[model samples]
Target: MYRYDEFDETIVRERVKQFRGQVARRLSGELTEEQFKPLRLMNGLYLQLHAYMLRVAIPYGVLSSRQLRRLAHVARRYDKGYGHFTTRQNIQYNWPALVDVPDILDALADVEMHAIQTSGNCIRNVTSDQYAGAAADEVEDPRPWCEIIRQWSTFHPEFSYLPRKFKIAVTASPHDRAAVKVHDIGLILKKGEGGKTGFEVIVGGGLGRTPYIGHTIRDFLPKEHILSYLEAIMRVYNLNGRRDNLFKSRIKILVNTEGPENFRDQVEAEWEKIRDCDIDIPREEIERIKRYFAPPAFEALPGESASFEAARARDAGFDRWVRVNVVAHKVPGYAIANVSLKEPGRPPGDATAEQMEAVADLGERFSFDEIRVTHEQNLCLPHVRKDDLYAVYQALKEAGLAAANVGLASDIIACPGLDYCDLANARSIPIAQALAERFAASGEEEDLGELKINISGCINACGHHHIGHIGILGVDKKGEEFYQITLGGSGAEDASLGEIAGRGLSSSEVVDAVERLARFYKRERREGERFLDAYRRLGHDAFKGAIYADA
Candidate 1:
């Protein structure tokens, strides 16, 4: 994790002070709600349907045990006893008082964390593969680059107050776990011709009302030129991106209007002028950042632990959890474990203060004091020893975090919909819960196999429903909740947006519709075919028949 320097500390402290005064003025009626809106948003505060919501950034989804503990403390002391982990790998407290926001920011600053850029139109938290440093297949860790971008974009005078929110994701692995293709800017780190690590830059990818997979703008950009290239892209967007309409304000809209090829040419032209400018990341600086993410010390040991094998043989639940939660690590004896937040019938990506505290303790005890939040909205103990897997599983199970549902049909990704979000027109959580229960009751999940079902309450696609093997989008129809289903979308290396099957189903009919679709896939799939593969092979016609046969 990148530690905050004095400069970083000072800036955050000053910003907190400024926000405190702004809040005071707003409450005092000196500033109207319209005047206070942008300021509050800039600080990661939002006025929800009922109360204010504060989203705190957990940079690159990396947190120290201390920071995790502090977050638990905040959850307990400030608002409700729980917080929601978002798709962007940030945490949101749904009920924070406007008057106490400065205090909340102060508490976050104490742990070297803040809500800065977690919201607003400027660059939000730069995210990456949660398994960046530990993944065996990675060419390089992507966190350092994410950190570099975070630093450059934070309070950037030139790029602040963009037409809309900007997102950037980086991944060093051949597999696109960070969903880079769907970001405003995506960087895939790869080995260049001379075996030098660099970035494959993709620009203008986003999902909202209009979704797009980013177009590759630069096949290869040397690591040192990353910041400079990013600046060039931002400069182009700032100068040329539409400001006339909020719906057409995103860079994706601009890219679509100009065509990707022309947009690429424009970015290249801008890059040529700014390639060696002040933001040109120096080699020394990059090295300095990289050092922070170097792998932790590990003792070499046998790949398979005798004790773990014994536990698996003895405990069926533990065995199931181990199968789904544990991931292969680069280190011989260590494994990365995902602590699932999507337990059956619960809000997805939500952790109570007690569960958060338990995870912090486990991270300290078993994961070398480090915790990671996956883009999939799960907590990770990134460097747990294989021998300790059973013990960690037991602890997690006790805390209700040991659900063996990672990447399964029941492990749904859903946003805080109309229940919490002002922009949402429908409720997403209840639908997710209903579907999860339906799948669990049917015992049909095993048949489904490696299915991803993501739900977003609106077209913002915050829940990443656009890429699910089965995607569900909630919409408002005359004050009633309705859901639209899409099939065959994927967020991996071969990324594709899902196509809607047919008419939107009412909330009551969605789970049954999904079940029907799953049943259809089971009957129609070739041997060993996954849902996505089957969907792609058979096309929407098969699923459409299943969903609308009785409609």
Candidate 2:
């Protein structure tokens, strides 16, 4: 993890002091709601349906055990006893008093963390593959680049207030765990000719009322010139992106309107100018940042853990967990273990303070005192010894954090819809809960095989419903909640936006509709076919007919 230097520390503390005064004035009635809106948003505070929500950034989703512990402390002290981990790999406190925000910010700063750029129309927290350094198939760790971008973008005067919010993601692995294709700017690290590292830059990808899978603007951009290229893209968007209509403000809209070829031409033209300036990070600084993410010291051990194998042979539940939650690590005898936040009947992506602390402790004891927040709203111990798997599993079980449902139907991604958000049309949590319970009780989630079910309260796509295998969008029909379903969407290397299956179903009918679709897939799928693969093969008509067969 990147530790804060004096410069980083100074700016964070200074920002906290400035925001403290801003908050006090608002509390004293010196600032009206309208006046305080931007100020509060600048500091990552949102006035939600019931209370103020504070979103704290976990940069590139990397956290030290110490930082995780600090977050647990904040959750316990300021707001409710839990916090919701978001798709952006940040955490949200749904119930915080307005006055205590500064204190929360201070606590976060104490651990080299902050809420800066977590919101607003600026480049939000740069997300990446949660298993960046640890993944077996990675060409290079993308976090150092993520950190470089963070240092470059934070409080950048030229790009601070874009036409709309911007998002950027990086991935080095071919599997696309970072969902880079759905970001405003996506970078895929790869080796070019002469084995030199560079990025394949993709632009204009986003999801909201309108969604796009992004277009590859540059086949290969030298890694050294990443910032220059990014600046060029930002400059193009800032100059021509729509300012008159909020709906048309995003860079995706501009890219689509102008066409990818013209947009790429403009960016290339801008890059020719900016690339010669002093925008790129020097090699020395790049090496310095890379040191912060070097692999941990490892003990020499055989690839297979005898204890892990024996335990798996003995315990069915533990074996099931190992099948889904554990993944291949780059180093021998190490594994990347996912801690699922999606327990049955629970709101997806939420963790109690206790659970957070427990995972922190587990990471310290078993992994290398490091944890990662996934784009899927889960925590990961990026470097756990295979020999210690059972002990870690037992501890997670005791903490109620052991749900062997990674990538399953129950492992849903849902936003805080009408239950918390003022912009929401219907409740998202209950719908997620109902569906998760349905899957769990039937013991069909494992059988369904690697399905994604995402729900959003509105068209904003906060839950990333546009990319789920079964995407559910909540709609208001005559002031009543109706859930719309989209099928075959994926946010992977083969990224594609889902298609709506037809009319929206009432909240009461949505779960059964999903069940019907699942049944149809199970009955019709080829051997070993996942839900996504089957859906793609069977086409929309198959599932659409199944869901509406009983309608």
Give lDDT tens digits, candidate 2, residues 259-287: 99999999999999889899998999999
Predictions in order: lDDT = 0.90, 0.93
TM per candidate comes to 0.98, 0.99
How does residue 273 of candidate 1 score in lDDT? 92
Point out the worst 10-residue segment of candidate 2 by lDDT: 293-302
Question: Cα miss at 291, model 2 (Å)?
Answer: 0.7
User: Residue 237 deviation, candidate 1, in Å?
Assistant: 0.5
Tens-digit lDDT string for candidate 1 (404-425): 8888899999999988888897
How many backbone collisions does model 2 have? 0
Q: What is the lDDT of residue 186 in candidate 2?
A: 94
